[model samples]
Target chain A: MNIVVLVKQVPDSGADRNLRNDDNTVDRGSANNVINEMDEYAIEEALKIKEAHGGEVTILTMGPDRATESIRKALSMGPDKAVHVVDDALHGSCAVATSKVLAAALGQLNADLVICGAESTDGRVQVMPHMIAERLGVAALTGARKLTVDGGTLTVERQTEEGYEVITAATPAVVSVWDTINEPRYPSFKGIMAAKKKPVQTLSLADLGVAPTEVGFDGATSAVVEHSKRPPRSGGAKITDEGEGGVKLVEFLATEKFV
Target chain B: MTFDLTSEQDQLRDAVRALGRRYGHGYFVEKAKAGEHTTELWAEAGRLGYLGVNIPTAYGGGGGGITELAIVCEELAAAGCPLLLLVVSPAIAATVINRHGTEEQRKRHLPGLADGSAKIVFAITEPDAGSNFHRLGTVARRDGDGWLLSGRKCYISGVDEADHVLVVARTEDAGTGKLKPALFIVPTNAAGLTRSKLDMEIVSPENQFLLYLDDVRLPADALVGESLDAGLPALFAGLNPERITVAAMGAGTGRYAIERASGYTATRKVWGGRSIGSHQGVSHPLAHAAVQVELARLMIQKAATLYDAGRDLEAGVAGNMAKYAAGEAAALAVDTAVQALGGAGMTTEYGVATLLGAVRAGRIAPVSREMILNFVAQHVLGQDKSY
Candidate 1:
């Protein structure tokens, strides 16, 4: 089986504050690039399956030249190979534009399965994989918490607000992993060294038969219209004293609706 | 030449963090208290090539180095499942076998260690020796095509769970002008060998054991590397790896503690419904500790690289330095996380306090913080030997 994991280079969510600038765009300089958190889960899940059943894992990502860093990280995580889409126009692009570019890149690779993170940490819009599925005309599963692939049969469990929903799809489908799924793995030193030699094929929009007019920030469906800092909160009343005074607080709570 | 980790290393960091978060501190705390190993986490880590990060690819390993090994431990410890066996199994035993063991030994043990199917425990520290490695009393005498070993070892970790133990002992007759140290692979179930559990007060999943070798015999091939004549160099090979692994364990523990504290401080509410993190009282210390942890992690990577590059003594110094820094950083990070969590930190359900005792061991066992400082003072700083 051949599996392709869609890894995105995003600013580390924990360090996302560094990416903010007065212009309302992600400050590229201060932003440390990393694989999307959820996509890491997808890559880990894919590796787990490949380890159990003999297969090759191919990592796919569409971003600038630096995005290959995320792909290399995926490859180091034991992926057999990788594909990097290096187009300057993809910078500051929305999820839709990114998905369209990735779909074009992935279209050229032959794979039995494709997996992606449910949402990129930078833009939590959560629409990339679904849009990729539509573009590629493949069955799509979103928010998968658990995934198992057996002989071209795919079983996925998705977390819902109320409970969970389990769905099974055929081979050659797309899966967008949610955060609740299996924990992703850190690249071991061996993976890192070996990743240096692993094949990472690079392509541009023209290589995948994609026209320049259909890509870039203009192609993105969603854009930030306005941005502002969250106002600092006001102070609260202090509940002073203890013991008998605490009992008085309980009595006060009884008089209030909190009781 | 880049100072940052390679892309793959970055991916590994992200992946291990994600996987570790799945079970997290709550699960690890329960397992530690019950004295049960996190076999689930260990198995998953092994499958993902996280456990044997440094073992060679030909042996079913990731073909990485000590840096990967350290990353695995740091990531797992950060995720709350710091497996001491990761240090013992692949880092020490498997590494020794792969480097020095005969082809059969490497072929037999490497795959299992890499896949987590077989576990090998490392035993070197003895009660009598007590860090004075040359003073160890364990002796192996030649028998009929085998060796009869007799001695005792203390504070050996995870012997009960090991398939075999790589025991460090002296071989050949003592008074015959032939005095040298040797290593032997002793099956844990070998007859005439007895192991007793040490009732440690700490709550680590891996327990220490006292090993007694009473006329225990092993095959001739069990002696790793060269014969008794070339002892010290072979012994140091295994010992150096052990030290580097300890450093990795410290890195993992520190990462876990910092993550827990950072996550809590980032969003935890306080006065005026604002995150308590906005207050200097809470945020400043965390920031300080974060710097310390990062500094220790840098030392850990440097040590791992030197070790992987086969710079032995330099690697030793780096390992000791990294281990010392990481031990302190992990303990402080966990303690700070607990404090930052306020009331929730103390609760068993919260799981931060469990790491407190576990991280403390980094400063106490394998090698103590004082021991590391002493080593640095004497060896690196050219100070007088105090110990």
Candidate 2:
């Protein structure tokens, strides 16, 4: 029961974000970097699986050196160890390239199972699970609303537009988790202190056997052509609901062709 | 000189903060109102090894110091659920034993203290002695290899919950025939020991006790260290952590009050068609409290650092000043919160008024504000001792 949780560091959800003017890319420097909120769910899920099945949880993340902060955070939540794929060439890598690097590392670690968020708050690509699964020739269960592992099979309630559909995959599979699965537990003070001694291995493209020509901006098939800041929204009109306010509201809605 | 916490420390702070938020003010208030102890939170904290952060690594505890422990105290207090036992148990008793206790003593206590399985409460204050160690009436007489102890301890926290009481007593030095201070591990259920709960004003989860030890007999192994010479250093070692923890709690409580006041004023509208926070009258006091709280926290960090580095003399001054500043900050913050909420602050539903008693008590207990000023006048200004 070896679990590898894929985590990411993104701009803090509460912090203000800006774009780099030169490339119209996100300004990772201005905003404080924090663990992707959805990745917390993934980490929690992995911890739960480990707790129930008796296995060690290892955190796996692909980002710049700054992303190690996010890895430490997951470790604080009681992960046994971590593998950080940090390389300059890893920057500007799309979902496909990112998954390639993750699969390579997971293969090297020989992970029994890989868990990830349905979508990272920063990227919102929602393609890592399927992409990594396709690259590894393993099964994938994405958009998991409810997850349970029994024997060698991993089962999930895949959320759909029309209710949900049950999905199951055999061992050595990829699974994407949603926040609705379970509330993440706060790392105990003991866990934080213990995490300092946990091993964190840093790897580059060479270490992962990833080619320099297959990652980063040069390797990315998609690129941001143009972007702009959204215009500041003005205040909306307020209506007071007096005795005849309902009639006035009806008239206003009729005037706007909404009723 | 650098004030920033390390990345690992920051993570530790965040983790404890999350734990605090999970319990929140309501949990503390409910427990206090129900006259029950916060045993759940305490057990969880202990089980997680947060309580043992200051204990040495070789003792089956986290290899941290008072600096790390203060972070835990401050964050928990900031969430409006300060664990007062932390001040007595880990910060004092644990530190003393780790510093001066024999290998047997350390082995018997440190692991349990680190894991929160066994709680040892510290008792130094007596009805007649107070802070004056020379006036202590507790005496331990050597009878063969064992000792006979008699003492009256007042205002001791968590005596009922603890397995043993670390009693500070006067004993004749083994070699010198003169009476000197010594520390003894007195069992709570010892044959001659009796305890009565004290009626206190503050609504906290911890209860105070008046302990009467009438010729309590203890084995020779009950003594903390081999020599009377080590007692003073052991006691001083405990005091630094105690004062530092007090300062942390005060700063945290002040922060909690200011947050409540600001949150209330930001939303509550009045006759002027503006939020109460927009008014100078409502905002200035909270702003002032914020500054004082931040300054106190800085002092606490400094004092904790000095203490862990074995600079007790320096830590003493900083710890005292930090405690005084933090007390004033807490008083001001809680006062402003009460005024900010007008009527709701008086009610227990909002959870602001419950802090009123606790904040006021923080100023006087552990050590009073005037005593701190006296210490500065005598110790720093080189003036003649007044008391």
Candidate 3:
């Protein structure tokens, strides 16, 4: 079995984030970029599968040059190798354009399974796996809380608001996992040292058969006309007890629909 | 020359930091207060190969050097879980055996040390020696095909948790008929060997002990190297690594204190709704401590690099300086942090005061600041030996 995991480099959500004034895209140049938090779950899942069965796990990342840092970090988690798709044309690409470029790259790897996070913290789009699955003509198993692979079949427990639904698919499927799937392991000392020597194949847009006009800002299907800072949070309502504090607290809870 | 750690080293730092944070200071304090060891954290680190990063790869280690081990020590200490045994066991005991022990000794012990399953604590500070090895009272006399060791060792750390103790004892030189230092690996549970824990004020999971070796018998193979010739060099081999790692831990503790205090003071408000950190009175001390800690860390890096590069002489000078600087910096940082926290600083819930004793002890233990200063004066400055 061969597994390909999608990794993204995003500005640390714990820190202040900004948008570029010129294009309103993410200001990656000035922010601390780290591997997407959810993608760690994906990497862990792929590693678990590879550990259960004898196979290879490849980390597939599509971003700017700095994305290699995140790729190295992911590889430190015990991936066999990595495929980095870096191109100037991929700059300012929208989610759809990213899916197209990733799908094109994945086509060359001939992976039996594709693993990714259900949603990215930066975008929260939750559509990359489905988009890539549609393009590749394979089953899209999204929001998997649990995944089990046996022979040529893939089974997942798709998480839902109420519970989870059992979803089954054949080979050559794309699986997007939720954080509940598994706890990711920290890279060991040996793993960190070995990651530097692991093979990381860097590919360009031309190598993936992607055209500049198809993925850049000019070809993006969606555009941010303008962006602004979120309004600072206001002081919450204060409750003073004058003997009727319990009644007033219940009323406040009812008003806010929190009870 | 570049000061930057290799990418692998950087990753190892980040990885060890993450692991340390997961266990955190709370776990450390809890275990210490409960009279228990940090078993879970130690096992996890062992499984991850963090504890054995400096051991030889052939012995199931990561095949790194003291530079890597220092990173592990500093990162963990920076996370508020300073393991003193890391300085004693891996840094001193493992290095001594790996460097001077015979092939049979390495094959017997290195694998256990590399995997963290076995711990060998160093016992050299005797009740009467007081840093003067020539005056050590511990002696080993020939008994048939073996040796009978007798001595009283003081301030020995982590004796209960260790499987073996590398004892520094004096043997009668056959030709000269004078007492010469020799190292013997004795099982902690060997007959006639008993230990009594000392009540220490420091809040740490590792405890100090006063060990009595009364006619503790050991086999001929128990000698570290093939002969008595390996004794002096073996004893000296562990000193550089011990100093470097202990200094790294001190620097890390300083960082932890500074980080904790900075985090608190940055958000704690008292006057005019401005954080206390905004005032120079509170911030300057932290900034000063930060500078001192950073300086100590640089020296630690230099010492570790030199030692790993086989420049033992240069490493000794740098290592002593690093230990002195780090010891002072850690004490100052922890004290400043406690003061900055004010009333909360005295409280255990604040976590700053919890480290007060440990940092205070760092200035005096293993090697004192005055001793290091004396070393620099004599060795580096070409001054007359003061003591």
Number of the top candidate by lDDT? 3
Docking class of 2: medium
DockQ of each: 0.29, 0.65, 0.86
State which candidate has the highest TM-score.
Answer: 3
Model 2: lDDT equals 0.88
Candidate 2 residue pairs in clash (backbone atoms < 3 Å): none
Give a tens-digit lDDT track for model 3, residues A1-259. Answer: 9999999999999999999999999999999999999999999999999999979999999999999889999999999999999998888899899999999999999999999999998888899999999999999999999999999999999999999999999989999999999999999878887898999999999998888999979789998899999999999888899999999999999999998
**Backbone clashes, each candidate:** 16, 0, 0
- Point out the higher-scoring one by DockQ: 1 or 2: 2
What is the C-alpha local distance difference test score of candidate 1? 0.80
Residue A1 CA displacement from its true place in model 2, Å: 3.5
**Could you report the Cα RMSD, in angstroms, for every candidate shown?**
6.1, 2.9, 1.5
- Candidate 3: regions farther than 4 A off: A239-255
Candidate by candidate, in order, the iRMS in Å equals: 3.5, 1.8, 0.7
Q: After best superposition, candidate 3 residue B309: deviation in angstroms?
A: 1.3
TM-score of 3: 0.97
Off by over 4 Å in 2: A51-56, A160-164, A206-214, A224-259, B1-3, B172-178, B271-273
lDDT of predicted model 3: 0.93
Q: Which residue runs of candidate 1 sit more than 4 Å off their true CA positions?
A: A1-60, A74-82, A89-195, A208-259, B1-4, B173-176, B258-292, B329-346, B369-374, B381-387
* Number of clashing residue pairs, candidate 1: 16
Positional deviation of residue B342's Cα in model 1 after best superposition, in angstroms = 6.5
